[model samples]
Target: MSFRTALVLLTLLCALIWWQATRPVGAPATPSRSGITTSAASSRCPMPPRTERGAMPLQTDVPAGMSLQAIGETNLRPLAGFSIEARVLGREDYRIGHEADISPIDLALGWGRMTEDAVISQLDIRQSSRWYRYSWKDTPPIPVEEIVRSSANMHMIPADDAVAAALRRIERGQRVRVDGWLVEANTNNGWRWRSSLTREDSGGGACELVYVCSITRE
Candidate 1:
């Protein structure tokens, strides 16, 4: 190849790499899952009441092959045993400080008829460490208050490596069932982290700190 041609090609390659690295990530495509109905009428279904305490014991049938265990208090206080079957709205991974050693998966989960609504697709949802954020161009399908209460940003502390790996593999828009306990962690220096049992509130201290014992995709 001619020397001038080679120089031009190298410059183009550099530009391409730069563009690829600097480009923003576009919004994810709308998801379509079997048995999930995403119609405007479905949004009219009543929203679940706001919870102020821990989740009740599993009354619904547990998925086959799933195991349950009593999580005794170790260093953290096990406030309540909890479980939920919801859709994975968003996920964020962290790698810093004590949290780096355990509890890396932070999931924004949605349940009820909201799981099938196009509102989720219309909104740009994202999670950064323990925080969740969303934005939309047009009017939201449901009330913003209902959406806040229906979904939550949970900090999942996996009970084992296998469960952690499973949580890591969860994708956006997939249905996930999580079984665990709500806990509050305290450090020797007096720093502490606790889970919020209520879904009606927002801002600081509203996130659930869960020690997940089992996780599965539906």
Candidate 2:
């Protein structure tokens, strides 16, 4: 190819890259375009009322999967319509990693008896490398089985910048209500990330992949 032609092509390529990098993923003003502002959060540990605590997340079946194409050729297939009011037991953010390309945050959430201060006080919670773990010195505070069923590590895929901002501001010990969908992402390159359909399971592959449409805090 001629040098002049190659230089022009290279300049166009650089311009395209810059535009893609600078574009907003979603703007706060246009949240309605993505979904409803259904989820929210607040700062720090003064717990929600008992009435707002202690309930299992609600998941509605989507018979056809409700698959939606997103992030290039990746198809985010909705496994169910999911909503949960729970305590933020832990929060982890990923900015530079393969997983961060899609889900940028992971929340360690607890509900049911796990939301009780009496129970929470007895446990030590920590999140690292996308895992949520809890422990208590001396005797166990509650049945290990109940703990397993009541808590989970969830991957959050913000539907828009509005959701992203809210999710980023969430703090541990705050009550959170998130409305969204359980999803499985499949890329054209055969990469896959799936959400666990059951809370009863634990260990690897147990985390929920949540595409958040709305979040609420405080």
Candidate 3:
């Protein structure tokens, strides 16, 4: 063949070979209507099914709320910036086991006493201008002489409506004892710990507000 013809033929052959080698193989005759569709993927390994629910999810980082009915003689440490005292009210079916999940009490009780041997409402304590008297007339006010002169002592500040009601009981001089978590008393943050407390006393059931106070036990 002539040199010019031979060179032309060789170029054509190379182009054809390159085109053929780059062509797709085993692909659908036509492009998929959905475009580049991919197959559903399976996980690399099988996962086990979830087993069960754990114990009640109350915060382990903070003290759990208790009720007056459950009060017993146990040594308790004074919470920083807070104080704790106990008085004998009565016995209660405190759920030492799965009581919360099973027979949950209508409310918690027995953390404080109105007197040396009485359980009073936590609400009453906060309400008593004599014992509490923090805010009045929209701004802080000096307590009257009777409150300052009275032997009544201070109790945990209510963190929520429930706690407020409990304190109110003490304010009214109703005998009450309540168990609760001790926390920094912030009016803004108190809602998280307030609880509606109920107790069967004086042959009748009563309901009131209680605050959850923090406690530490070994």
Please, what is the whole-model Cα lDDT of each candidate in the order they appear? 0.67, 0.79, 0.28
**lDDT score for residue 46 of model 2:** 15
Model 2, CA-based lDDT: 0.79
What tens digits encode model 2's per-residue C-alpha lDDT throughout 1-218?
Answer: 99999999999999999999997554343223335443332211111222223457887776552454486566788787777889999899998865798888999999889888999999999999889999999977999999999999999988766677878878888887777778899877898999999889999999999888767773
The most accurate candidate by lDDT is 2
Candidate 1 segments exceeding 4 Å error = 1-74
Error of 3 at 78 (Å): 11
- Stretch of 10 with least lDDT, candidate 2: 41-50
Q: Sort the candidates on TM-score, descending order.
A: 2, 1, 3
lDDT by residue for model 1 over 76-158, one digit each (tens)? Answer: 66666666778889988888867545567789998765586577778888888579988787788788888887788999876
Give candidate 1's root-mean-square deviation (CA, Å).
15.2
Which runs of model 2 end up more than 4 angstroms from their true locations? 1-54, 63-65
